[model samples]
Target: MRIPAFLLAFSVLGGCAGGMSKDECLYADWRAIGYEDGARGASASAVSSHRQACAKKAGITPDMNAYLAGRDAGLREYCQVSNAFSIGARGGRYYGVCTGPEEGAFVTAYQQGNQLFALENDLAHAEHAFAAAEKRLQEINHNIDHAEAALISPATPHLERVDILADLKNLNEEKQRVKRSFGPLRRDIDVAYEELADYRAFLAANGPYPGAHSVTSASY
Candidate 1:
């Protein structure tokens, strides 16, 4: 069996996920590898990368015919609107693998799922920003209290008192600025939650994409 030259030449692996490990490569089944990628809706380009991995690790040559056949079977599992929705919900990228009537429907459903994902992420980001801002506010308040204590101390020098007061002023200004942003952040969170709810309701009414055969670690 002839191995592809590109597989033998490239040793560096990057963005080539779920390729054969050293052990699997030693006893490689290229068809099964292809099937897994197809099932996961991975691009056709994955074959070249996987071939490289197995070649570099175990000096094994892939049977391209078997791998192509397996991938075709796997594509049957991947090409469905329901699977597309799930993939988008989990923030996975689609490679537009399906042809025929299924492609249009799958892309439509996937877009809605992607919208939900975006909203969810936006809400999460806003919440994190707000929490971090609030934490900073608390830290500033704590510092101000300490500075106040130092100012009242009879042993404290005049210059130190002046500096402490100036620090307190700056901290208060920053606190006010953060406080101003809080309302907008809350609004953003609320908007995202509403949009997410709408998308969820839509999918709930419209979906469950087609593949009933679940992919598992054992399959890999």
Candidate 2:
């Protein structure tokens, strides 16, 4: 899509305790951090992770008031239709950060983008599964062929020949299993492509959501 310079997705690595580094805890800027988090569409509860991180590592606490103020300002920037659209296209989730008209507009756009992203993901995953299954089927068939040849070999022992027969039977079963799985994967790919086409047609007819300027974090 037509992504803008400022609307680019920024990487925000966060996990337990907000995954803040020692340096970030020591040099914490509540306002700036709040702004960044807000821009990234972090939920209000997200601050708790930071709070815990800071408290655990540095024995300090975040400035809640300052952080909230900064977050509000950042949300002002993040609550834009254009940013929401980009976020959705990139398969990003919204945290209900925007309110009022901005909230409705952003969410609407985000959902549209998310639809396309989801379909693309399904298509990719289905394709990958189908390819992997095909490879496995080939391997099983080759092994079965070799086993059959060995079974009839004059040098093969009777007991060993019996084992080979069993192996061949199991291999055939596995091949059947893979073929069964392939059917679904193939179907999934078809469904994904169809849905994608529908979405593309809708977009072409309606155009993208109207763009709006909002402040968002470099990472959101």
Candidate 3:
């Protein structure tokens, strides 16, 4: 069996805030903190130059705008000490706006970041599910190819060939099962995506939701 030259596997990221997408906002913060220049500090000038030369050989641009955009956005959280975290709610310091010696400061961060984190995790789950489906399909294809090859060969095998034939039938059934599951998986992903889109629209219309349940400060 011949495999297709192009195989499309779906991969997705969270629905970012509509007002100023999380990725773009994160990148802006990274730039504000001077992360780009520091990244090249560990590499010697010649090694960096060689990497650029190799990229050119591969028909890849050293100055990739899109790649840099992702790099900055992905790396921003790591640049800061407490950019994102998870903790229980213990609201006290006016929704923990200012840094205090109390424990509630930690909870405030968690409350503020929870929605974004949940959205991000859901997107990750969707990607993982899609990948698992793709893997199952690949296994089915491989089994089909091997079984077909075994059946046609004029070797002296009898019982083994019969087993291979059986395996081929099983693989066919597995393929149908995978096909059936895909529809439900797609529907679940679509529903999650719709929720994300709604949240994004909400954020855009009204600014980021206040961190705490009660009115905290005029700044937020």
- The candidate that wins on TM-score is 2
Q: What range of 10 consecutive residues in model 3 has the weakest lDDT sum?
A: 3-12
Against the unseen true structure, what C-alpha lDDT does each candidate score? 0.71, 0.77, 0.47
Worst 10 residues of 2 by lDDT: 211-220
Native-vs-model 1 lDDT?
Answer: 0.71
The residue pairs found clashing in candidate 2 are 10-219, 39-217, 77-214, 77-215, 78-215
Report RMSD (Å) for each prediction in the order shown.
8.3, 5.4, 16.6
Give the per-residue lDDT of model 2 (tens digit) for 1-220: 2323453344244423457887888888888778777777788898898888888888888999989998887787777787777688888888887898667777888887787688778878888888999999999989998998999899999999989999999999998999889778889889887877777666665555555333222222
Clashing pairs in 1: 82-209
Candidate 1 to truth, TM = 0.80
Q: Indicate the residue-level lDDT of 5 in model 3.
A: 19
Across 1-220, the per-residue lDDT of candidate 3 in tens digits comes to 1111121011012111122333344343423212232221111132244234434444332334443453344333322223323211122111232233533544434555466456656766886797799799998998898789889898829888888888889999999999888888887687777766665555444434333233322322
What is the model-wide C-alpha lDDT for candidate 2? 0.77
Residue lDDT tens for model 1, 148-213: 999899999999989999998998898899889899988887887777666556555544334323
